[model samples]
Target: MKKILVITLAALLSVFFIDRSYSKHNQAVIQKTLINEIKEHRQEPIVTIDFRKLYDFKWDEVYVFTPGTSLKNIEQTLGFTWLDAKSTGIKNRDDMDLIVFVENNQVAQYIMLPRKYGTLQPMAQKGNFMVKTS
Candidate 1:
């Protein structure tokens, strides 16, 4: 009976340690991939964004965008289109509707709304910092 109990406990402990290690490793890989994707599409010679600071308050993910960063750039980096750029009213300085909300110098959320509608619609968001979208 004692030997059986000892073996079961050891197995449980091993599984727990293995899971923790795998989670950490997976997160590191995801972070590295995101950074590389951003760097590959950015117009600047050196990418300046520090990805470590943008932690998801709930989902454990990161979201980033800058003022001049175009919707096309985001589409290329993320490999998905959230909204049509033409419909977002991002024409010239007067019609521009892109906004990058930041907290503590890190991009918390990005929104693109049409000028005519004048309503907030998140193009990309992360965690509890911004409204969740489907």
Candidate 2:
């Protein structure tokens, strides 16, 4: 009976330790994934940025705008579009300034990942950062 209790206590302790370790390393692991994704998608120079660096800048949701898609399409994809862009003489899809959002200095998210530019995936399917027109 004593042996059974000892084994059960050990098992519970091990589980608790493992869970704690995972929680402690979660942020670092997330950062690594972001970096890898950016490296995979980054072309030539690899234009990368971090969220904390651009904390001064606010952003909207990450919107995917494919060819044949219009502003309305972007609005739908992003859930919000720059109403001012349309009114402020900022016309044309190419004319819109889209900034990629990164975390821990990695390109973790963006609006578009054109094959010509590069294919970028976020570390997490969803992150704390976002892309928007600057």
Top candidate on TM-score is 1
Per-residue lDDT of model 1, residues 1-134, tens digit only: 99999999999999999976775575555545534544454454333333334433323333443334566875565455555434444443343245433455343344442233222232333332221111
The runs of at least 3 residues in candidate 2 whose Cα sits more than 4 Å from the true structure, single-residue gaps closed, are 1-44, 57-69, 80-82, 88-96, 100-134
Candidate with the greatest lDDT versus the true structure: 1
Q: Candidate 2, after superposition: displacement of residue 7 in Å?
A: 81
The C-alpha TM-scores of every prediction are 0.36, 0.30
Off by over 4 Å in 1: 44-134
Assess the local accuracy of residue 122 in candidate 2 as a C-alpha lDDT between 0 and 100: 34
**Prediction 1 global C-alpha lDDT:** 0.44
- Compose the digit string of candidate 2's lDDT tens values, residues 1-134: 99999999999999999976774475345445545555654553544444444334334333234344455654554444544323322234442233344334333344323234432333343433332211
Let me know the TM-score candidate 2 reaches against the reference structure: 0.30
RMSD of 2: 16.1
The clash number for model 1 is 0
